[model samples]
Target: MQARKDKQVNDMVEKEKIYPLIVDESENIAYISDPETYEVIYLNQAMRETLDLALGEDYKGRYCYDLFQNRKTPCPFCTNDRITKERFYTWKHYNEKLGKYFKLRDKLVEIDGKDYRLEICVDITDSEVHNKDLERQLSAEETVVQCIHALSGNEDMDVAIHSLLEIIGGFYRAEHAFIYECNYSENTVSNTYEWHRKDLMSRKEKLQDIPMEYVAQWKEHFEEEEAVCFPKYCEEGEARLPEILQGLGVRRHMAAPIWEETSEKYGGEKKIAGFIGVDNPTKDIEQVSLLHSVAFFVSNDIYKRRMIYKLKDLSHVDALTGLGNRNSYLEKIEDLKAAHLKSLGVVFVDINGLKYANDHFGHPYGDEMIRSVAQGIRRYFPEYSYRIGGDEFIALYIDGTKEEFEERLDGLRDYAEDECICDFSMGVNFGRGNVNIEEQIGYSDSMMYVEKQVYYGSVLDGRRLQHKALARKLVRDIEAGRFEIYLQPKINLETGAMVGAEALMRREGEDGEILLPDKFISLYETEGVIQYLDCYAFEEVCKLLQEWIKSGGTPVPVSVNFSRLSLMGSRVVNRLAEIRERYEVPPELLVIEVTESVSQMEPRALKGLMEDFEKYKFVVSLDDYGYQYSNLAILINMNFVELKLDKSLVDDLKSNPKARIVVENSIDMCRRLNQVISTAEGIENEDQLNILKEFHCDVGQGYFFSEPLPREVFLEKFGGHHVF
Candidate 1:
């Protein structure tokens, strides 16, 4: 919103410039007035003092003409007559009531979609200096000096750029002056530091991803170390000049290329950072040397600021996650001690089972989990979150009251757990003014640890704690998409043709090792975290199906195993339905594979859950049929399309008569019900394969034909072979 904003106020520069600068207040008086009402919205102390008015009082909404001149009505000699929505007017005027002459400049500035006039009135009537060239050069140098002073402070970079832009704009007498930065990574350019004459529109929002190749000629001139100027844009022929210069409505243009004295790789070559340009609508090119000098000062200031940022980043930013580092947290402690912060809040976040993840899934998986947690912190509380230690984070809440902060923290916790799969323990404390930030952080961390201990059953046993911790890390990995979807082709035993494949979940380990599901599934199953894992697999399968469809392929029925934990509620139905609709995958194309434990769960609830899937038209199969308690009632009630004989039965088919009897009975039952029976595992030899073929098995998955393959390999090898 527009009030009595300082002359250097610019939204573009102040928000993203990270490193800010501090500057002394200008001696000249300034104020902004609503043009429609001729009422003052802001009047600075300098203006009040010069007008013989009281300071620190409510002068806002006062009639500008009446307050300054004590007039019963409007002033007869108004500078606004020369200035319009697109015009800036600068002149010397004598006040009728005050009996004093002043040098003034006025431009229309829009704030919050409202029109106002920014009036900068300098008391130059009593000045003894009269040399125009000397004054102009001195003024430019003075503004540069003030900007340099600001750069010395540990303030924001936006403020520094704003101050520099203000000086350059006034020096060139331009309608607009802006900094165009090149994003080397994206190979694009954007308008960053921008200043428009009051009431002028900002073009920063409209300028995005401008290809550098579009302005090759302009850059070539800068490479020659010259401030490229094209005073006559329309007249410049397209044969030798860049057409992009004309594309922008640049009339009288001059820009100097900004450079940094550092390199991306240490001891390597220095590089060109970007460029600074100004549009001179008034065509005042006499101060060309002065303009270049100011641009040089800016170039060096930016370089220094970047260097400082680099040094600061090393100490302040976490190397693994890029969140605020421990050093940054400690610095904030001092800042908190110094300032009287009203309603300061702190949220301590600790990742569960990080060690377990690192040990079981490998450090890479653990690292990805930590990064996901950090990303969540940034999403919820940017500019306030810190990575204080391995798997430990802290967030400062300063903008809200204690209650508000607690509410937001609660919402964040729920979101992270339910949607992001980020299992975390959070402890928070906040309220009132003048709090000990360090103590609060410690207190919050302690509360988090206590809760964590409670989750571990308050036991001193290391193995139990370790296992529970892994469960927590598994949540993070699942949330972070750290699992790989490998497809094991299921072949038709009788036809000797490839059919559908089962989606297998695998995690990446050290040196690109593929960690299998059997490695940790049992532990997760025992801990009841298998439900989330199953959901993750389902979501990934849905995503893969959509991708295959996008690539112009008809996919087969992909089997996704379901846990008993997921069958207890409508949560899985809603989640799976949402993803199914999003991918536009028909329900019949996705096979729901149920573990034997699910068949043994609360029979009524299990039947209802299976019915819900059937209602959605999904093909349901009982997976690992002979492993656990075999309740034959589910098979009759659920209306299954397939049954998978347990691996134990198939592995002992040659020696164990009981296993063979169970397998034969299962296959015979499947035949009676018009169902498909698939025998998996222990299919390494032809004898075992032939045995399954004799039993009239429909499909088989194991190392006999092919192991599980990555998406790329699967697509290359069997994705072309569609069952439907």
Candidate 2:
């Protein structure tokens, strides 16, 4: 009898419903349970009253899915089954008897290691709402399919991507959405699509709806192949993104990327194809997985879509110059830096006036002249070059070493002078290594003022008739091979072996007498021929230097004075860039000098120009330091690589204690700021050199060790001397 009673208890426990709790206080209904089972699992009074079910009828021993669904067993599609190792079902079903639709959600419970499934049923009897929800799902699927087809068909990629995002937003009932893609070639991710609700779009045409952090999250997704959810608009609660979103009234968003597979065969080819996202203004929560799937879908299709966008991208590229269009350069720079990398140089080049040539010869001749300069540079710096503004060009070089690069400017300068096409001025600068690209650009422009100051100073004399005539004669002679390149020995004060030499420009008159820039520079400047003269001198110097490098000459950094007149226009930068490319010259070997006083343009305008100069990898020096104490604020703000003391300071430092103190103070400040301090015009004796050395100057240049010589003469005399 005891064994029989135990069996009865086990059977009761095995029943689906065993416990019932219903009080007769509020409603006229009954809670039913199976006598065999002990679980209080029936919703009788509350559920029967709500759903109009019959009370007192027992639903004991019946499973949740079996009650709501027609199936006797668990449904195939169920999440409860995943959590618990039990047969389970979802709300999807067709009831042949009642022909009613009902949706159910379920949870699993464990008691003494035994699993039981609990569930709730919602009467989804309204056919309209059910059909509408189905329609929404179908619409989203169709839109995804359409985007895939468009992508596969190789249509206009940007437009297709934008439209695809729109369809996704509509399907998901989102207020806004966007797509971003990673470029395998550039290793960059850029915005591909963005859309806002029609209500918002009608109000604000330019929607600043997307936050940088959102874009940043997508980048992380691309890198890590993970999904991101923005629970709040801003994680730091800094109100930055929250403000923007609140303006749009958007509160929540979900983003994901289409990740590329890594393969040894395509070592450098791994990149995100694209990403898709959705945003909702009023919704407190978003369906994260769905958004991620949409993003992944978009990214997966990017490979074929890029082929179509390629043509559009090419259309924006200048065929003659191979540089980005004016419209594209600004956007490209922003995107490039947003990817968290620094541009080594931002070189801005302005071609000397073609208007004069057009008026004198014809438009065709002027165009050819422009083409010549463009072709030269395009062929030289194939990696990066852009014709951004009218008669203005920009180029970015990744491997720029300033001091080394300036030395190679001779070839372009010579080419321009020899052709006698047009004159040019250039300004170049260095980046703060880790600073924002905009700041880097600003600094470069400020350095350019130094070049511009000299340019303006040169053009002053050319405005007069007499000065013009003399300048034209001198320029013609220089272009006609009447100039010689002088090389000055740069002794390694430590060893005296031929280290390197400075390439100085001088005009060889009809009598074979050499005249330096100071003698005829005024003439060139006044005659509007300084650009040609500068180019002639520069190119001649380059040819000789190239030869020296080939003829077993010691490799030492060479300093070249790029006359302010020579760098008056943008063409100088491109021309120099071409020269470096043509000769395969390393940038570290070149040093360019500019007077700080020359770059007096508005800070905003000059900043980008100077930064562009440094992007080309040439060390920029203030040729005459201390003369422009007025502009020192801007100079310090722009950040020069070297502070070259003028001969005025060098000549007076030893004789005048005050002058020495100034020089010493300047050196100290430069040292603290990580700027190089060098002495120029150190001449006559070792005493001056010793004084410079004592002041802890990094380098010295002038006529004491040896005057500028011909390239061959320089190599013969100073080649071994420059070696430490």
lDDT of each: 0.73, 0.59
Best by TM-score: 1
After superposition, the stretches of candidate 1 with alpha carbons farther than 4 Å from their true spots are: 1-247, 250-308, 316-526, 532-558, 563-590, 594-724
Predicted structure with the largest lDDT when compared to the true one:
1
lDDT per residue as tens, model 2, 1-724: 9989966665665453323212322343223222223233455455556545575665555654455444565546544435433533455444443565556444454533555554444456687456866866666566657766655554566677667766667666778778655555555555556877778663223443344454454565447546666554366752233344455555665667676665776685755556667777343233455556565656556654555567778867776555677667777777677665543666556655455445544565455556666654555455666786656666665545665445334455565455434555555655535646676666666665566567657665323323333354465565577777777665544454544456667776535677777876664554566777666655655566576579776467676776555676665777876776676667777667667655765656467557767788767766678764635675566656777676777787668998888887776777877655454455557777787677776666677766667766666656666443
List clashing residue pairs in candidate 1.
13-158, 19-156, 19-157, 20-155, 20-156, 20-157, 108-198, 108-199, 343-432, 353-469
Worst 10 residues of 2 by lDDT: 29-38
lDDT of 1 by residue, 1-724 (tens): 3543542453333343211211132566777777778888766667777777754576767898888878877777776656766766888776766666678878886665656777777766455234555787787677667656756553788887876676678767787888888888789888888988786777777667789897676577777645767553445553243556555666577777776665555566656677787875464465555555666777887777778888978888898888889999888888878887777888898877777767765777678678877887787778688999998999888857666776778777766665443356788888676677777778898999888887667544445544444566677666655788898888888876777888888986545577898876776777566777887888888888888888898777889887777666565676687888988988877888887677666767776787677667778778888786687877767778888877777888888887777787788888888655554554666777888878777788788888889978988888788441
Error of 2 at 171 (Å): 99
Q: Clashes in candidate 2: how many?
A: 68
